[model samples]
Target: MMGALGQSFINGITIGSSYALVAVGFTLIFGVLRVVYLSHAAVLAACAYIGYGVIEVTNSAVAAIVVATLAGAVLGVVIERIAIRPVRGQNHLIPMVTSISVAIIIEETLRLTVLSGQPISYPDTFASTVIRLHVGGAEPYFTVGQVLIFALTLALVLTLRVVVQRTWVGRAMRAVADSEDVSSLLGVRVNVTSARTMALASMLAGAAGVLLALSIGAIDAHFAEPLQFKALAIVLFAGLGSIPGAVVGGYLLGFVEAFAAGYLDTSYRDLFAYVLMIAILMMRPQGLFGRRLTQRV
Candidate 1:
């Protein structure tokens, strides 16, 4: 039982790292645009498929990953320029609805063309190597994929943190997030900042899609939906625009699901995210790191 529990804990951390990556990307878009871009889920799914095709053609995981990340970056700019930008001018809420429409369209396109609406086995070549881990009286094994996921998630997430907190682009993003008018006056190109933020966030999503595909061992048009919702839950749990908070929330949810599935049934795995989110909402609507508005009377 202890060994099983320990394994679950490890699994949770690995899964949580991916969750944090997705949540941070989701949060970044909200920070700049102040709107929830639901189409992000579609972008992530599409990138995973793109990666699959790349791997199929090149027979190289590295190529797949690179192509997927680049594809996501391009799609981010495209969506920002085409779909979101047009509706964004109308109202902040308008983009949310418009993005949903875009997401649906992308979903349908992928289903009809890619799957004809059926799930397929994900490539396991990336995760074929198995390494045995020595523990106290319990031999917990590790896979190349799991180790890769943890390492890449840590490195990428830390790199993102540094870029956000210590770079000119980070400053511009923070400035725009604070107030577009003020940022513009300060010589921070607001439009450019928004586009860059989208590209950066979407790239993370792209990387995450590959990691997710490697971990899950199967792919489908809508497989990313649950993960997307879980990412939203992490975003809310960490607060609306708190990138660090999202990271923490991602790992927390990951552990939660891991333990729950370890001791209980897999059927209840997805249910806990909504329950946890609801609990967080009831307990702290502002989130763990969210700032409350203090309006002057």
Candidate 2:
């Protein structure tokens, strides 16, 4: 029984770390730009496919990740330019609709081309190699890739914190987030800040895709779309635009899912976080880490 519990804990952390990565990306964009970015899942899926292609050609996961990160950053800029920037200052819903349109276009393009409208196996994820020291068991507690995911998530998220809190670019971003018009008038480059913010967020998004692809070992054109909702739930529950809260919520969701699947019906796992999210909203509308913002209509 103790062994089972320990294993479940491990499972939760592994799964949750990936969720945190995805949620952080979503939260950053919303926190900085106030854009829901409906096309995030499309970008993730596209980056995964791009990573897969790189793996096939170079037989190196590192190369795949690099290529996918660049691809994701570029895509983020493109979407910001086309779907977000043009719709800036318009009704928020308009940009959401435009983002959805961009998402649909990207998904369809991948479906017809690289994806071939079907699910495909992720090549050589290296899931079996144990990287941790043995703890008197034949098998190690965690695999190399899982450890890497955890370490990489920690590093990337910490780096994001430093970037946002310690850097001049981050200052511009926060200023824009506070008030774009004011920031622009104050000589802050609003466009550049927003573009840089999206690129940073998209890099995390792309990394999440590749990491999850490695864990799940399979990908379909639309598989990531459902996960986007999961990430969104984490973001909402953690707090609107609360990156750290989202990270914690991601791990919480992972634990919930791990235990739900372990001791209860598997189907209910997906519903658990959402139900909890609604409950949290009812009790604390500002979310676990979000502050209530007052705006004049």
Q: What are the lDDT scores of the predictions, listed in order?
A: 0.84, 0.84
TM-score of each: 0.94, 0.93
What are the per-residue Cα lDDT tens digits for candidate 1 across 1-297?
767777888889888988988999999999877888887788888998998888778777678778998998998998888777666646777888877888888888989998687876766675646776667777666677777778878887888889889999999999988888898899999888888988998898888887788777788888888888889878987899888899889998999888889888877877885698789878888898898768899
- Choose the strongest candidate by TM-score: 1
> Which ten-residue region of model 2 has the weakest summed lDDT?
131-140
Instruction: Name every residue pair that clashes in candidate 2.
Output: none
Query: In model 2, where do residues sit more than 4 Å from their true spots?
Result: 125-141, 293-297
C-alpha lDDT of residue 152 in model 1:
78
lDDT of 2 at 288: 88
The alpha-carbon lDDT assigned to residue 87 of candidate 1 equals 69
Count of residue pairs whose backbone atoms collide, per candidate: 0, 0
Model 1 backbone overlap count: 0
